[model samples]
Target: MTYYRTYENKEDVVIQFLKTRTDRLLKQFDEGNYQNRYEWYKEIFEEILEQKEITYKILKTPQLCAVALEHFNNFAKVLLPRVYKIEGDSTAMHNRIIYQTGGFVFLMSHWVLDGCRQSPEEMAHLLDGYIHNQ
Candidate 1:
């Protein structure tokens, strides 16, 4: 049996939303054609962004765009393969990746929210390198 969490903080709420949303998108990717999966992934990503009150337009600013792009791409590449290795089936692997992705997103979001003041490019390089090296 699974126990659902009730989130009181904005960070927790956003992370929880991403956790569930990513799981659904991963399932869509598993079932969809290549093109369709990309589309579905975009739609679901947009939905989660809205739920988190995060604006793509805002994230695209020169200071932040690199971080957004790098983390988004690298997280999928690094995390998905690891989860896939651990869980054979598409569904099970995706379920695990959901939590893993959410945790990373949550930590990064907290860094941003806490006014870390690092440029997105710097953050991306630091984070992507860390994840890749690990």
Candidate 2:
């Protein structure tokens, strides 16, 4: 099934999708009502399946969870340098590094609101250049 585009390209659609879903997941995780990370991810992935206009064939819940986790994990790894750069110039917040996964979650919340405006692949490339050792 073809998912119609409101954005310029498939990349744009994916970027928007990631921003939206990540924002929701971040919020739910922050609320602390969920028992564990997998449970939280399960709920968010179910919501994505229900609400998003996805073109991929349906899969089992575990499969959906796997996909979501992989995407978010890649995003976190690629974006880590940017987060470190932001924090490096400041002295106000250090927790972002202490718990890297949580830091990524918080950063993703800002991404949805602030808008990265770059595609994920672009961000990953920029990250590689910025970090050098990655």
Candidate 3:
């Protein structure tokens, strides 16, 4: 309510809150020492698993989906090229990134909304396979 008062409306409050959370996660990823993208993603999923309830709420909210997608897009753009050499046309590379990121977001949203039954390690492994199999 206080944030709603400060912001324009509930959606603005939600967007602000999501951005803050996403930014913090991204910052942590940047700071943490990881051997590979798998380790980086594992740490990320672990953090989200720690806040499953709040994460679920955020994912379930339709208005906030684009914000979440944007964060994933930004994360993918940085992380993917390091993991795989995506060569050829710039537009092709962009589309590939978008495709991979969208799949990741879809998997994450489903996992979180489905009570996050799999452990973070498991989710990371699954994501690893998904990325490598492409």
Ranked by lDDT, the better of candidates 1 and 3 is 3
User: Which has the higher lDDT value, candidate number 2 or candidate number 3?
Assistant: 3
Model 1 lDDT per residue over 30-75, tens place: 6654453234434543454454445333243544444454445545
Q: Which candidate achieves the best TM-score against the true structure?
A: 3
Query: Model 2 off-target regions past 4 Å?
Result: 1-6, 51-74, 78-134
Check candidate 1 and list the clashing pairs. none
Ranking by lDDT: 3, 1, 2
Mind sharing the TM-score for model 1?
0.33
CA-lDDT, candidates in order: 0.51, 0.48, 0.76
Model 1 stretches with alpha carbons more than 4 Å out: 1-5, 33-38, 41-134
lDDT of 3 by residue, 1-134 (tens): 77656998656766676667667756766675777768877877887788788778778777766666776687678656645656554887788899998888889889998988999999999988898893
- TM-scores for the candidates: 0.33, 0.36, 0.76
RMSD of each: 11.3, 14.2, 3.2
lDDT of 2 by residue, 1-134 (tens): 34554665545555567678666766665576676444554464355435433523212244543454456666554444453445343334333333454543444333333444444444434333433444
Cα displacement (Å) at residue 83, model 3: 5.9
